[model samples]
Target: MFSLLPLGYVGVMTADAGWDTIEKLVFRPRVGELLFNTVALVVVTVPICVVLGIGGAWLVERTRLRAHKVWAVLLAAPLAIPAFVNSYAWVSAIPSLGGLFGGVLISVLSYFPLVYIPVAAVLSRMDPALEQSGSALGLGPWRVFFRVVLPQLRLAAAGGALLVSLHLLAEYGAFAMIAFDTFTTAIYDQFRSTFNGAAANMLASVLVLLCLLLLLGESKARGNARYARVGAGAQANPSRLALGGFQAPAQLGLAALSVLALGVPLFHVGRWLVAGGAEIWTRDALATSLLQTLGYGLAGALVTTILAFPLAFLVIRHPGPVSKLLEGANYISSSMPGIVVALALVTITIHYVPGVYQTAVVLVAAYALLFMPRALVNLRAGLAQAPRELDEAAQALGKPPLVAFFKVTLRLTAPAAAGGAALVFLGIVNELTATLLLAPNGTRTLATEFWTLSSEIDYTGAAPYALLMILLSAPMTYLLFAQSKKVAGQ
Candidate 1:
């Protein structure tokens, strides 16, 4: 427990000192508007995500959609583009498409994959024979879909929706571009301009409650059976429905959406690259920002991975209230917006210790706090598969607890652990809000650099940094997909 002392001291002391600001900011009308905006984004985005996800999954996995395998890859391609990158592209492409609608479009495009991937996995694994039997028993096609397919999709849909909601909650860049003020943006403004830590913590508390509600709603939707049978192998047969007349329109719709969502953004980036040429790299700020981003990314990824191990073990092995609380605590940081968390930490840091202000360590710690859940969920899945008997066997072989864990359990869980670490790394690299606030005065990350350049209407000049960020992230995306494939044994 004392191992956690340093962290507590830093967080607690700063938080206490920041109370006055937190109290005043908590009741601001802007905070209310920000809260509303946050809720609205999630509310609007969730349905679109579900519809696209469920529809795409059903079309590719269960129907005779034209070029099924091709469609599958295309649909999942959106996951490669970072949310903020997509926002930057869309906002730059059509200045008219700004604010709430613009935010919605960017978010839906970037995150629908979150819904599509999991729901599609569920659909792929479902026993389609049941649907066939329903049809054989005189149940109409509509009846079969509503009664048979929908129920099976509930848990997956819930999980995916939860992820989408959380992403929306924490979103910064996209919403920021569109002029949609949410708790995250507001918190960032407060910290950067006002340096009010207390106000930030109070807002963070509210955001945390909102996230808890979302989590509960997700759990209630998932229920016991769906959560329990997440990765179980059940015999299933591919049931493909012929598109016939619908094929042409379906193909066109999918293609058009893909182009609008993905193609346009890449085109915008290219245009910037062509226009700016050498001006983008001439700035010293770009180099500083890139270095900052790399440092934060490395530290956040390592720390999150380390912290995730014991938490994953507890959830996977213990599976009780205590474990649930631990897991839930991890979830809070992710679900609440990054600015809110940063502000909370800022308050804690300023009031308590005041020693670590604007340090690289605080910024990295904020990243870990925000993205640790990714590691937790991924590692927990892999850990659950490791049988209890293996531990006993390792012990019987004269291995100590730590040695047995490393030689046996850790080795077996390596792929999942690595996948989780990659996710944390990717998230940290792309992270903006906490990086913006807690980052040292001279430090600038790729995200901050992109923002700074863009803010000054130097869109062309920002292109290189934006493109670099994407390039760095692309490999991470590939790793995520590759790991998923391995997990799926595909």
Candidate 2:
């Protein structure tokens, strides 16, 4: 319900502005241009990401690829570098980087992990029996793969595509750094000028419509297809396809991709660090930003994980229509762009709870809304592994339900919960749009500080924060990778 507050805010703003004003605001040429750029970015970037993501996953999981582990790690490593940071690296290297081409390149590098991670997991656990049956029926490998294998990937691919679309739509810093005028950047610009006036509100409404359309499209495409295996014995490891003479080309392609996606950003950040000199690492400023970022990440992760616990429990323990509806609502709310979530929180607190306006509490609330899905995913995975029989057995032993939950179920789930928190921490450390708008006075996170220095073209000064963010995110990314494998039943 809290997640829907942003929708309410948009609705109220639209009603206040009325139909004529909305028609005027939404129908302008500049608005049309922004929409084109934004939609074109999604249209061009997602399929490429999907192809690259699925291809990378297939190479690592289903082929006799050399250094599969190394390739897997390298492919997923781009997630550690935020999109805006990726854009900064590209622009630093090629000063003329801007527009749709530039936006697609940087975004693809940063977000393909969204598709790659899940698709890789799906590829990893697929039962060999299905493919074997297809082969026995006189099907060629490509036919079996397309007919038998790829269909199972529909859910994961669609979900990944939806995430990528949302990221592209909500993105501000990455696009803004390159002067790509999406609705998000335009709304931010309007807010700078008018401070949440009709123009910004109207742009946000259009963006909300785009988000809903993507959600609905994904749902429709996903439609009630059953992929679960029945009459299953123990699942067998999928057979690896022989690359034969094509091996060299496959290896070369992945190597080139790594160079473009992961190598460029790391090399430029290192170059800046070298140029910055030892003195550019201001001890006081760096430490404060580092500590504050840590504090915010920890606090927000804790709150989000706690909130996700009961919801995760409900959905896992009781899989009914009510649970599904509640879970869906949570997901739909979390799908809202961070900028809209932040904007809503800012407006809500100022008008309804003025004392808490710009407070750390509100900032944390924004993080909770924006990131609750991450925590929920991990918690649900954890809870699924823990059977309710154990809880009932504890109750049979005379312990109260709450105590049994804390001592037994909670202990069993702690690692996964911690894993979820770590993912949330990684997100908070790199988050820019919401933190930029919602952070309280005198607050400076690593992301915000990095953006500030980089905005002034102090590339050298920004290097440390980027390095720190990547370093901090590395372990969490590994955790996520490991978790994917585990959950995929590999």
- Largest lDDT belongs to which candidate? 2
lDDT of each: 0.77, 0.90
lDDT of 1 by residue, 295-334 (tens): 7787788888888898898888788998887676666556
Error in Å for residue 229 of model 2: 1.5
- Cα displacement (angstroms), candidate 2, residue 342, comes to 1.1
> For residues 360-447, could you state the per-residue lDDT of candidate 2 as single tens digits?
9988998888888899998998898788999999999999999999888999999889999999998899889889888888998889
Clashes, model 1:
17
Worst 10 residues of 1 by lDDT: 1-10
Backbone clash pairs for candidate 2 read none
* Model 2: lDDT of residue 71: 96
Candidate 1 stretches greater than 4 Å from native:
1-32, 197-202, 224-236, 279-288, 398-402, 481-490
Q: What is the lDDT of residue 89 in candidate 1?
A: 89
lDDT of 1 at 295: 74
The TM-scores of all predictions, comma-separated, are: 0.88, 0.98
lDDT accuracy of residue 376 in candidate 1: 84
Predicted structure with the largest TM-score when compared to the true one: 2
